[model samples]
Target: MRWRVAFPGICVLLLIAVILTSQGERHVSLSDGVVAYFKRQQPIFAEKTVQLRRHIEQLQPGDSTSLLAARQALRECRISYKSIAFFLEYFFASEAYVFNAPAKYEIEEPYIEYEEPVGLQQIEALLYDPQVWQHRPELAAQATVLVQTAQDLHALLYQFSATSAQVTESIQQELIRIMTLYITGYDAPLLKSGIAEAAAAMKAIDTMLTPYQDLDKKDSIKYYLQQGIHMLSTQPDFDSFDRLSFLVNNALPLQRLLLNSNHDLFSATALKKDVFPHKDITGDTALGRRLFFEKALSGNATRSCATCHQPERYFTDGLMRNRSLTGNEVLPRHTPGLLYAAYQYSQFWDGRVQSLEEQVKAVMHSPQEMNANDDTVLHRLHNMPNYRGISLLQVQASLAAYLRTLAPFNSLFDHYMAGNKQALTDEQREGGNIFMGKGQCATCHFAPLFNGLIPPRYNRTEFEVLGIPAVDDLTHPLPDMDSGRLAFFPIGFYKGTFKTPTVRNTAVTAPYMHNGAFRNMEQVIDFYNKGGGNGIGLSVPNQTLSAVPLQLTPKEKKALIAFMEALTDRDPIAH
Candidate 1:
């Protein structure tokens, strides 16, 4: 009798366990898949995705924070419906496989909960593999059916919100394509005969993205397409339609940050192939730009190369005049700024030098500038404690290497021309047209880089002689005024010729002209409006400035100024 009673109690205990298991298994399954996929797809989201998925398992409908975090992580990464579907596909595939979830979730967290019985059932089925492996050959097939069905539902459900609404159409296209490609290969019954339709759409979609996918068009569309791809994340900026448009057309993202930050940040942001591009002058060019500012390596120990080519005020000293180490007011053509100098064919106001390396060593040896001999510089750098780390000769070569990387790529005009329609104000666009056409600025500032002409064959620089009176006495030209390139090469063609500086960073590096004769953009345009240097009523020699006055209205003059500002790389820095 005691044995019989013990048997009934054992049966009762087993029944209790079953009821508990049946109730909780759904929660366990939901938590597992949700957390697993998040970790797999977005390694960044592993911790939070797991935590939230666990909370989702136990909570009553609307009773947890996980759902909110799910919405948020999705929001932050700008993950879209396609990304979500892609996540779910790989996430649930772990059920038949041993994919240990890397993310640890604590399901006990407090939250407003929501529960779906169907979602719970799918999660449990994926978690527990019964002996169906031996008895039912169709069980594996059922797994495929269950997972695909769940993904299709997710794709349709994602459209209810505004953030994913934009790419919802694309998400559908992608999902259908996935189903078409691999779902039919499953050892299962057809859920529906939509396979043929899905296959047809996949081909069509491939053909459709073809035009937009051309490598030639990549730069133009990258900014916009990234928006769509980013929209795949949860925390996308969908509220601001204007930003949505801008983000879609321009993908500055981490690249802009990396460019502006310190070296560690640059490396961390993109340790691999993500770089600032060849135009920024990587490697040899980067080395050259670095040596530009280094002072101790220079001769006399007092001057750095930047003493002439300053980075502040957009790579030029803001001063109207500069003094030499010899205490002579040579004025040296007002020290030309080196903004985007890499884009220019020539190096300086006189174009005496051909390459930046030659220019660096020339200044080192010049009696007027650094006044240090190149050989002396080489000797001094050879022993410096810090520089010994780098070959002294390498540092010499490095400065030239670094100078080539000094091109000013970040400017408003670059943004405007890069297909961001809203980058320039309407007035600025009109001004650009005027400058290029009727304003005659484009006659001198040509295409590709908008300053100096670059031929396909030779990379030599050209110089021009523009006659303008020296500062202070506009009536009489300064005695012993420099004749520019002519004095250097002693060639008549080189007479009064100065290598044209790239007008890219012009908005910031002012006082204007090679001599910095004009103080501001307006004054410069006004000088031009009066018809070059002569039209301004200033008597000058070798006057190559347009002799006839431009006769522009004040509005037109303002437009010209705005356009010059727009020429700035990236965004302009106010002084």
Candidate 2:
């Protein structure tokens, strides 16, 4: 009788063991799960897109209620897009631009392709204008186009497939997207719904990561995601939102957790291939350093790269424009600092060259600049004890390598982002918020690099037609005559277009803009506050900068300048 009673308990234990074995044997495909998640999200996104278009169709310019309804619909559409943005953007980047691109005409070089401003950003620009009635037809048309693209995207979603590796990689890229674009109000400048969109994106990432929760034993990623979403949702105010605190406390920790969990899925070496395109030579840094200060590379043998790019002034000469080779006239454009030059996709103000090596060679040969003859320079280098066997190519490589070392991410602002709360003051924090929100500086000067290199991909650099004045006289300004990228590309949209440089060391690198018209950060801020060159009454039909005044208070402007000042590197480049 006792044996019979034990037998039943044994059977129960055996049954439990069998169930556990079956559960362990069943393999869950993360890729399939991710694709299915996207399919479900597509319909939601499509419906929201249709809703936005309908709201726009019924919009009455003078009707306040209608306008408010349309704005709410726009917010909904943006949030829905954010939910699946990671997959959509990673797979269909070109098609994705149709749904949300910048509100300006753009020319893609090499192909000479022209793209008109369209999508949600274009609609937002029109709707948020004080004179919405004036742009009624344009707003309706943009909304209609957006709905059509959404339909196309929905159809394309049926064929979507991703490897488990891609799913994790996409999540990582989305994290970068949130940090760079979404939080900065890049896409939703007028609506200021970037925070909400960021939350939606994180939620989607959290859902995708659910299958891997067991893999993350600590569950730190889930905790941070929830925390970040809560903080974003609670803070509705765009200008006063504490972005620094959010980034340091939540977003950064989650990023580290994800990166550590999936070391095999993403390799640092592979990502560096995208970031630093060229093959970086080993054991050449010391040689490159010596060549950077070598005066013999120039035609006159009087000026080295350091002469124009002085280390004392953050690698800039601190002039409106440096003197030409003969010292008879000034160089055509302003001498930009070399502090973070290597981080850009393209070099120079006009973005004519795509590599630092190419830029170095161009400067060496330019008559108005270094004015060096290849044979002569090679001969001079051969005589030097350290650079005896160096060819012209080696010289170019060395100089490029040296430039790559200039990026030292130890600024006060960087420390603040890295979790040092006292690195920034209250005024500096307010200034940073304004820069990311109302000022719209982050739209062009993206975070981390704070340059024109587009984020998430970082494959292309952006050029903008700011329509800079020839002088600082906003009251009686003249449009700069410099053709910029147009001189080489011969495209109408490229007129007066220049690459956006990093503003990291701007407090030290004075004489701003392509022409160096603005002498100080205050002047530059004022120029932008008044709405670039177009708002100041200059004739610039192709100006890409919005012609709307920033409407900043005096204190805000001072704080903005102070925030930029805080970007100065902790370790000086002067040795």
Off by over 4 Å in 2: 1-27, 152-154, 157-159, 214-219, 261-274, 277-283
Question: Best by lDDT, which number?
Answer: 2
lDDT of each: 0.43, 0.77
* Model 2: lDDT of residue 189: 75
Following a full C-alpha superposition, what root-mean-square deviation does model 1 have from the true structure?
A: 27.5
Clashes of 2: 0
Clash number for candidate 1: 44
lDDT of 1 by residue, 433-464 (tens): 55644455644554335565421111223344
Clash count of each predicted structure? 44, 0
Cα displacement (angstroms), candidate 2, residue 448, comes to 0.7
Per-residue accuracy of model 2 over 1-575 as CA lDDT, tens digit each: 00000000010000001101123213246677767887789888889989988888888758999899999999999999999999878778777777777777655556766678888788888888789888888888888787777777667756666655566667777887887789888888778899889999999988887655644455477788888889988996777777777777788777767666322111222124224434454326677788889999999898889899888888898899999989999899999888878766677887777678889889999998899988899889898898888888788887888787787777888777766789999989888888877788888887767877666666566788887999988899987899998887787777898988989888878989999999999989998888888889998887878778888889999989989988888775742
Best by TM-score: 2
Sequence-dependent TM-score of model 2: 0.89
